[model samples]
Target: MKRKLWLGAGLSAAASALAGIAAYAAHRLSGPTAALKRETLFAFTPFETGVDWEEVRFNSVDGLQIRAWWLGRPESKRVVIGCHGHRGRKDELLGIGSGLWRAGMNVLIFDFRGRGESDDSICSLAYHEVGDLHGAIKYVEARLPEAQIGVIGYSMGAAVSLLGSADQPAVKAVVADSSFAEMANLVDFALANRRLPPRPLRALADQITAQRYGYRFEAVRPIEALIRYGQRPLLVIHCTGDTVIPVVDAYDLYAAAQGPKELWIVEDMPHCGAYFADRPAYVKRVAEFFERYL
Candidate 1:
């Protein structure tokens, strides 16, 4: 009888431990974000290409200051905006932005709130980020009316580009790299990579994140936006060796894109590391898209 009682006690302890783990995982799924570190692994800049840039700032819909670097002549109406990924700063997009500017288009690369020089208090990942993108469009329009606007986004920014363009009629072109179909799927992918099963845990995470952020993850589907984008020109690129976001995701995005669209598969690249993996080819492809559409 004592042995049986001990066995029951052990099972109860195990159940309690498992429940505790699930709770922790759900909380982590909300994904706390911080500012990018003072340094980066790559050296991407416009100075190397010998172009003078202007400092610029604009306020997001939520009244947060978004900082950016603007290049190209004041009279130019062809503008390209570069959106950085999670925990990213503007300079990280210098390589791509410089290439666009060289191709005779204005370029603006900015920081999202809680990431770089922008507000550092909170980051709702891609949910709150769409507002920042809207503010950028407004800023450019106020300064250069009747301008043709294009956007290139990486990772989280990639998803935001597609989501934001759904409402902005002026967005002429978009290039998205290494974006997940949905935020919840991304959370599940991250957990699975760590050897954690993402079943009930992912559901809990979804609920917790929605309650905290005041929005549902189901509403941030970029794939849905691509279907509705309607002939504005979309270029979706994915790296083959990306473990964080399976390369197969690019196929779905490409297939969903209804209008003039192109999909490029980067060979043996990882995550958002495509541009750095092959700078020349990456720049040429992106520039060609904007050249055709913008």
Candidate 2:
């Protein structure tokens, strides 16, 4: 009887520990929710001037309403679809859009569903966000048929654009900035950075994501996507001081790409701040790259 009692107790303890790990993982993934709220609430504080902004909305394949802005000179022949990072809306992309616009490219900046004015409240990371990119691409193709299309995506948007471009042939060239190699790696990095146990958190996050989205986070590996669909020219820009997602991920992506690619690492710039860190250099490189490729 005592042996049986101990065995049951051990199983109970193991189950409780597993539950705890899962909870931690879910908490880490939940970080974006609050961040999104903060960004939306303070959306008007930044970008006081430059570029004309117009509110626009379109329907995603899943029927979600996506919100965006058409910035700069609408008559420009060269066009760029700018995808904002997680928790960021089209307004946040104004700085980059203005630069691209001044470089003589029309910029279309949009917010993914569940962000800004778009419908939905949950982000499936890039797994479902790719659909948003497809919708944006279709919009661009229909409206700007004669224009050469290019894409600039940051973080989560970068991952979606990369995957979406792999599926769509119209994307002439791509600029991916501060992107993660995979959703699982991003979660693991977050947990480790917070001084938490990574394995348990990752396992839990995988279970939760699969239960909620019907797919595994590992299945959305951007590095693998880059390797598989490296036929188009890619420009990878990363900041050496990025603490959220390591700069090494950008290098890994650059190295894994099979086709023509360029990697630019901005010294001491944090996260997506590379553009602001060296505006002139950023504009020059981006213009030169698209001029050559597109």
Each model's lDDT comes to: 0.80, 0.79
lDDT of 2 by residue, 1-294 (tens): 999999999999987876777665654453344445444665752246466666667778788889887665666667788888876777777777777877877778888876777876557677777888888888877877877888889988888778878867788899998989887888888878978778876887788767755568777898888765758999999999999899989988998888889999989989988888977788888878887777
Q: Give the least accurate 10-residue stretch of model 1, judged by summed lDDT.
A: 29-38
Q: Pick the candidate with the highest lDDT.
A: 1
Q: In candidate 1, residue 107 scores what lDDT?
A: 94
List residue ranges in candidate 1 displaced over 4 A. 1-49
Clash numbers, per candidate: 0, 0
Q: Candidate 1, residue 156: CA error in Å?
A: 0.5
Off by over 4 Å in 2: 1-18, 27-42, 45-47, 72-74
TM-score of every prediction relative to native = 0.88, 0.87
lDDT (Cα, tens digit) per residue for candidate 1, span 28-138: 433454424344345455666677688789999889988888887566789998899876788888888888788788999998876666765456657788999999999
Model 1: lDDT equals 0.80
Cα lDDT, model 2, residue 231 = 84
Candidate 1 residue-wise lDDT at 97: 85
